[model samples]
Target: MTDQELQTLVEKVSQESFRQPFCHNARFNQRLKTTGGRYHLQSHDLDFNRLVFEKYGTAELIKVIKHELCHYHLHLAGRGYQHKDLEFKQLLKKTGGSRFAPLLAPVVFQVYQCQQCQKMVKRRRKIDTKKYVCGGCQGKLKFLKTIEA
Candidate 1:
């Protein structure tokens, strides 16, 4: 959905679920890499990751919206709005908001093997084969392949 649509949806969710109006802006933030949504404490604006909708669809997006709205409402009310607070936890549970964001990106691992002992290894980032050696055999390492998880 577009940013305008997201704003309206946030407003609708806030009113329906929390009995409060969302007066601040709500938009899809492509820069959000790991989070489902973010609520700015100062601006009271809500930013949602487009990846959530792209990967999990509208239902998941709505759940994330509800989650951020919980933060928005609770913070504006001058109550405990942090994740560790009892009020935030209660509001989140009462609204059926998601406690955690679903994993949105796959992790890539670079596979390497020891030239002498044939031992295999995996790393999240690429490493210089010339600089690093096999731990088990202390032999030169060679790049094998990359895998995603």
Candidate 2:
């Protein structure tokens, strides 16, 4: 969904689940890697990882929204909003927000193959084949292709 849609959804979730309004911004952050969503303490804005919606669907995204909203509302109300706070934990559990972000799909990365034994190697970044030999057989490695996992 678009950023506008995300903002609306966050607002809706805040109202429905927390009985509060989310006045700040909420948008999809493509740069967010591991977390499902982030709540900016300074701006009171929320950032959601698009991958959560893409891979897990809207239901999961809503849960993440709820999670971030817990932080948003509590922090704005001058209560504890941090993850370690009792209020945060209670609000999160009450709203059924996900306690942890779901594991995203593994990253897409380059693959290399040892020429001698045909063993495979996976790496997030490209490695110079001449410099890094195969661990098992010390065979020269060649670029196979990039694989999306």
Q: Give the number of the best model, judged by TM-score.
A: 1
RMSD of 2: 3.6
Which pairs of residues clash in candidate 2, taking residues 3 or more apart in a chain or in different chains? Answer: none
At residue 113, candidate 1 shows an lDDT of 91
The C-alpha local distance difference test score for the whole of candidate 1 amounts to 0.92
**Regions of model 2 farther than 4 Å from truth:** 107-149
lDDT of 1 by residue, 23-120 (tens): 99999888999999999988999999999999999899999998999899889989999999999999999998999999998889999999999989
TM-score of each: 0.89, 0.72
Instruction: Kindly state the number of residue pairs that clash in model 2.
Output: 0
> Where does candidate 1 stray beyond 4 Å?
none
User: How many clashes in each structure?
Assistant: 0, 0
State residue 78's C-alpha deviation in candidate 1, in Å: 2.5
What's the distance in Å from true for residue 51, model 1? 2.2
Model 1: worst 10 consecutive residues (lDDT sum): 5-14
Residue 11 in candidate 1, Cα distance off native in Å: 0.6
